[model samples]
Target: MANEHYAKFIEEAFVKPIRSVLIIDDDYPTLDEMLELEIIHKNGDLPPKSDKRWHDNPGRIKSVIDGFRQPQRPLLVDIHDGANVDTKGDAKVAAHLHQSDLLVLDYELDKNRPQDGARSIEILRGLITNDHFNLVVIHTSEDLDMVYREVILGLLGATSDELTEGEQEAVNQLIVEYEDVDENALQALRAAVATDQYLHARLHASTYMRTMGQGQQPYSDFCALADEAGWDNGNRRLVLRKLLADAERPLRARMRNASTAGLKWATSGVRWVKAESVFIAFSSKADHDDLFADLQNALEAWNPAPSRLFMAKLRAEMDEYGVVAQTEALERQHALAHWYARLLRSKGDERRWLIAESVLRHSDQLLNTILRRVEVFATELISSEAVAAGDNIEARCQEHFNVDLSKAAPKKKAEREHNAFVSSKSPQGWHLTTGHVFTMNSEHWICLSPACDLVPGQGATRNADFGDRTPFMAVKLHPVPVDGNHDVNSNLYIFVTLDGEVQKFCFNSQGKEAVSPVWRTLYAERRGLLDKDFGFKISAMGAGSRKLVATIHPAQVVAQLRYEYALNLLQKLGVSMTRIGLDFV
Candidate 1:
């Protein structure tokens, strides 16, 4: 019953107008279908022919060809010679041009000369001067030279086979370049599994794509494939057996017992074409400016805070990881920015509040500066410039709030001793050596070894006597502060590893000594930066050095004096106790 109903509906829906089509394809079935469609739409009557009115009538042609839409202005241009054509042939060609809407012309004419097609095309060019919209298809069976092939065929043809041998070989070589991409993916997956850092797989994917000039193809594909594969079989089960086989015993065992069901998505004809394109576009950027602009626009248009926040996160990511090749990045960034600006114009000021919140939240200096620049313009009416400046604020706020302690002085010896250890001697003997004296918090008490001691008697000792064996004559260094205390104890320890060497350290504690060794070949210098608000300079004692000094800024102390102003504002806003906490989070 349903089948009969559907058949009736299809017949009733698709069988009216039948005659208007100028069926050029030499194929009959398509013509029949067109006629059937015409009949369906025209109430069983055919369209009038020779009236020139059907040429203006609007209708869509369903065919493999896409560039052609209207039959009135056919784009296929034939450059056939007029000399070979008699008046009858000329009339037919003219009829095709005037009635059929398109004239597929032969480029060469045999009656004139060997170069008739090219000459014919040139001569007919006068006929379609204003009709540049008409497509001039230069079709030929002859095998032209490479340059001619490229100019005459390759650019015009939609298929790869249209390219010459050299071009095809070049394309094949390009394909070969990506042949090992799957292997690289496997290796990255294996490494990620070993490290238990699944996110690192993304990095590996990105790196591999960049290396092969494929941008993000391999990485995006891996992610999309993995996502499609699902987690039903456990992530470990989803890993390749070959990769796991070389892994340690436990991982190998996991692979052996893995479920094949998790791989259903992998076999579901999954293609990463779109994802690869996106990756390539993103990774090939010349600079982040345009991306930043787009993000700003999106953020301004985003609502509910979370969306804007998400955009901000994306902006941060792009700024950090976007390809640094300035030309590409800049071009992409500008184009993206322009598009985003248009999008924001469509969305209006609701996104502004979100942008403001995001900017204020970051507390960065550069971002704040940019924000301040646009503050005047951000009030009632917003413009693209304001959005841009606001975005810059969000980008730079972290830097704005950063404290610089590079020039600050070290803690006084008396202060360090008070903070780190309760030890003190009376009169002249109670002196602390000046070697980057500062308070650092540690869970364990620090034992000071006598590299060279001044009037040392015994040394320092831990008062807790909990697992501490190092003997001290006067007092032990309390590295961690007690509860409710503002003082910080010195708990700083530096470890150095040299290339191609193993480091061994021996420590004695409580009548027992232990030795530990670590690989030093991977050692590289890592440094920390002080915030812009931090106000201290750090200097450490080197070998044979007796003293180290740090300078402090008195102005910082004065600035902290005003910290209460902000705190009071928070308290008045009812946010101090409820929302504000000492923890960094």
Candidate 2:
């Protein structure tokens, strides 16, 4: 199946005529595939259906040549065991090198061979230089680090030379930087060099450097040196060299990971093809999880009142763990601020209200700074005559809201209306009317209705109707555990209203497709309700119930409601919403 996939890929991708193919690998299966492809290409017909070769390999050769359309048949030059640098492999490659336009060189070859594919490429660098082939692709499952080093060396024109004075001095300096080094290993490396085993010496030296925490070389400096030494860009060697150089740089200012060493080549530039392993070291996973858990716990326990002393403490702890990246630290602080705000609302602790308020204010300032830059950019675009006069208002709106405003407006309104109705509908036996909006005058609460009996004489409430505005709040969907033989087949939608009310509604999971669109609309519009006045009209309207009923599980419902409320509060205060796990339902 894998061979068939590759054959089909080639047939479709090689729209232009392939003049010839050079298959350089010790792998018999790969060579056989190429040989069969070449035969099919020449015949202008696929192998007969009854052929046992096609049956054995199944779709491998048949799929590629069944409808092969190219008028020109490409000649094939197969070089088996080309990885053996000391053998006639070099002579055979050189003899047939000019006959093919494409070279498919494997990265790994026979384990018994002294030279692998990379080493062969390194040795044949001179012969393959200056567009010797129209295309050359390294195809292998070899370790990326080994491949990277070999490719760089090959591109820069590898040479065996007596160590220069500067190079020797650099090596010595590197050794000195290590607090401890194996004297035996160092002596062995020197002996290897003395015996003119330059390759073995370099390998031993590299291992020593790696063991002594000097594995990272100045990749940028190396690239510069290679360029200065006059390596040409005929095969995009310069581009690849630069990519490798950038990838070698530490992702964090002071911390480095082996996995990240050569990642830039894969991530940046025009990617032609890639083969990568997905497995990561378990230690890396453990470290990541530990750091994440610590941050989450710190955020949950944050108290920002009086000053941001709690945040300072968390930052110090994070710094000790070598997580001093400013952006990452600030993001954690922002999330903590939001998380704490929700706590204050749920607990209504007057003592901690000041702290929560302060954290929120700080978070707001940070968010404003980010939004201001976006606003400035948008304003500039809007002010520009060229953009304003264009017919792409949808594009402009997309730039602002990440959505097509013209298309979304009606849909958003419809969703909002549906959510309002759902919220007003009864859960078990309680029905609530649509909420009114009330803006916050200060951090303290203010009454929306002047004539209302809730609060007297503290503040004058003008008769203000803010319409059926849904309060900006965070919401989470949680599963309701069913009792044995129970019939409720839905989860609960818990909402934290703007004014700190923890409300919930039961939603059937079967209706998620209908509910998700409404929920998303509400979530998106929640920001608009910030610093706004909102209150819902509540009433009990089913089965002569004067108070909340026992048909629904109150304890379970309340627990989920509070949890969602706190989370929503954090989101409202600009906490990273990604932390909320709402997909369970």
Candidate 3:
């Protein structure tokens, strides 16, 4: 009775459009009386008598049955007495059995009628075979073994090998009745019988029962059954066969609807750029080895076209963002293109050489162009200032550079009070007394004597003499970390060349006060330099080293001026210094 309640619950929850329920039992009057009472209790009407045998308190039972009856879900009920089995009356029951959507039977229909259960089984089995019934339940109080042997096994055709005379008679009766059935229905019944055999071999009884009890649609149910059965066996041929069966063939629209619904459910909230379809067809094959491989190849070959389309769209987006013409973006594109080009033109080791050479050449040219611009800018700034200031530059020159040029011309060597003046013989043996005096613009002072060793290349040896001279006066450029305060060596100085090239150097503080402090150039280039190496040995220099001085030799000043003037002209022509990597500051 509990199983019957659960079965009714399952039917109410999952099944739909149940047209009628047919009951086949030995005691027809008692079954009919109980159904009437159940309906009356469902309508909230109590029985006139309080006999417990007629009706239990209805309570939850009324609610369950009323719920099943709402909106008249099941329209009709039919009952047939099993006492009329194997007679013309049985034929009348069979004639209308296909009209019912559900079938409820008594397992032991009658003690006198030995074939009553078999007759019930035959009728239900035929309807199930033709796919006319949605559900079937044997509601008898008989033993479970009797039900399994006489009803379940007989319906499943499991005991056909050892059928009794009565069972044989029931089977013959079904054949005779099939003659009156429609051709299409008979064909479907035969196909269903074959499918039942296949299902029984693969699925357990519990799996079949549960699936049938809860299934929504016949085709979908068959698919679910096949999936459960084949899931553990690692064989899907039977599943595919069931899905592709002619009797249960899925409509094209249904397939597309199911697929679309599934996709929507699976990909909810996901964003996609495009959706399209591709079709691949193959002839049926007995061996599936080639089937999977062929499908894979087809899919792989089809992928590149769509992939290329997506990449093109991505490239278009990058172009809109100005990324393609940007520095790193251009470099990456060039590198990939150049690598592939080289690989195509050369073989093996030669390809590597070609790629490396192309990359190095591109890098060198880029660096050189950047450096040239910076050098030119710095040089022009210094030279233009020097020429425009004239003699008024002496004050600025004294402020920036330590050189002072305020004193009058010296008289005799003996009258000179400062030791800064030198009296010496030139390498050519000419005697000369050299005085350091300001140049015409007063920016820098030079040796007055033409034969002085202070002339370019003839000066006394100093640490600064080891490097080239720039006309720009050197000032203490404060050192600050470009990125953050975490730099290990923040005390740095940068000297800008007259042509705008900047050199970074740090003061070496290792020695005692016995010697003048020396500044070592850590990084030097025409453009700009960023040093990463620290805590390493470097050359030392004195404060008076010419390398520390920014003033160029007088002989080189004219050349430096001419170079800057040309750069200024280029700037007027709309050339951007910063674009070429020059930092004016």
Candidate 4:
């Protein structure tokens, strides 16, 4: 019955309003399909086929889907193995996820070849990371408490093992459904957690989101809380206890009210969809007065035709597109205009397909560029007096949004900037590829060996004649002091760029003398280094001394450094192959 709670709430809030939904399960909900399609999992990870509840799970979902009325029925997509998600991958799954108003996922996706419902979190996480707003509901006959706990921790970037003893205790205590706290509830929680035997109970997704999540902040503030707790016996447990306790304070009645509010909110999307329908209806059903009224409305909408306005927008909003991109875009506009004209003439499904096709044809960099511009614009805009009058950004926001953004404790500004250039990987990272960063004897270094020299099968042949079977060419990474007042924006720095001016750097300088004062100083020093110590300095690392700290992001090398700068760096290293420095220098 608890597992079936999903059908009742969904039928009431989702089905009636005709809200689009994406359902993910492992079965097609029929005896014939189940008999033919059910593949035995090697581990025997699920209940036996004889179990009525397990066998009839898909039938339950199908019943609710059947309840949905026709004549503008809600868009419903059912995904299972050999269905929407298959060997080709879940691109269609991602599209439906983005378009759907709600997501209904089975907690046990291990019913087929690709095991574990948790794996679906990877797709959901990717979408959320890109700032896609979404809600999710999980339905299963598994222990409800454990399922809820896993979903919360999984989405918020943590796992049960990462939790301290105290956090685990607090979580267990919170899951016990009781109108008021008592020794019995506390004992039940402890027993359930210890034995890993949890009982079924009702659950709600929105309640969890609003309760644990910090709204726009990623996750459920679980990451932030863990950071604050320091994962020690002290704070993590206390904060988690408070967060969970607060979540339980709201009753099931309040949950229903929130669901009601959401149903009201669904009307906005309905109106957006209905906007185009008005014209279609007008063409078919219009009498004399109706045609005249629509004509007046149509004229009003064309105050500055949307097409013309967007065309002039690139000129008016020059800062949004960097000068380089703006100059480059002029050549592409003529072709785009012709395509847009054809798109406008097309109707129905063809137009929608063309829109998707046109968007895909453009480079990802162009979309990413737009996003970067918007971030830059918003960051500046939010800090201004118009958004919030006071100077305290956090305090002002607490007043503005009623939720604190700082609670998420995301990667720091400086660290994120540095990471953009050098993608770091731990000792447990993938294969020892070229460009992997290393530190030995307190000095940073990079692998100068070709990728073939480190890859297992190819590397053996490449280094077969060397002193050590796994010998690698090495290059030193000269450090620029950026610890204190030293400007990270300086051209001397290879990684961290505080002001994002690093992108414009033409190998050494953006020049036009538009650079910061720090760059001017670094520029002269770099010039002097070339003049005095221009010779390439390479070293060899024998088999024993190859400990690595992190690996560099090659995409940065491909996108940003695959230029004359790379050629210059390569040429210097090439010319001095005859001479080299000491091991791990």
C-alpha lDDT of all candidate models, in order: 0.27, 0.34, 0.35, 0.37
Evaluated at residue 36, the lDDT of candidate 1 is 70
The prediction achieving the highest lDDT against the true structure is: 4
Better of 1 and 2 by lDDT: 2
State the lDDT at 197 in candidate 4.
12
Q: For this target, which candidate reaches the highest TM-score against the unseen true structure?
A: 4
Q: Which regions of candidate 1 fall more than 4 Å away from where they truly are?
A: 1-241, 244-369, 374-585
Every model's TM-score = 0.16, 0.23, 0.22, 0.29
* Total clashes in model 4, counting residue pairs 3 or more apart in sequence or in different chains: 0
Expressed as tens digits, the lDDT of each residue in 273-385 for candidate 4 is 01110110011111221222232232222222222223323322343355555355445787789878978986753465466557665544354555554455334543443
lDDT of 3 by residue, 1-585 (tens): 012222222222223334565656554444556788789999999955532211443453233234335674634666665656652226666666666655555555556655355555555444433433234445544543344333333322211123446645554444345445543433443444344333342234335434433442333444354344333222222232332233223222112111111010001121111112211212121222122233223223222222233333333333233432345334667666876776687764345445555666655644444444334433554465466556787543444333444533322111222211122111111111122111222232112222222233233254254453211112112223222223222222212222222222222232121222221122111111112321111122235644553222221121111223223322322222223555789
Residue 382 in model 4: lDDT: 37
Candidate 1 residues 1-585, lDDT tens each? Answer: 012222222222111111111222111123344567688777966554432222342221122122232364233322222443441234444444443322333333343344334433332322333332121222232332221222221111121113446644543443244344443544455453442222122223334324222314323443443444342223322232222233333422212122211110010111100111010001001222122122222212211122222333333333333443223334556555664565465432224333443344433433443343234323322243244446564332223223222322222322333422222221111222212112222111111212133112212243223122222111112222222223122112111121222111111121111211110111000111123442222232233456644322121100110222223222322321244336665
Residue 157's lDDT in candidate 2: 20
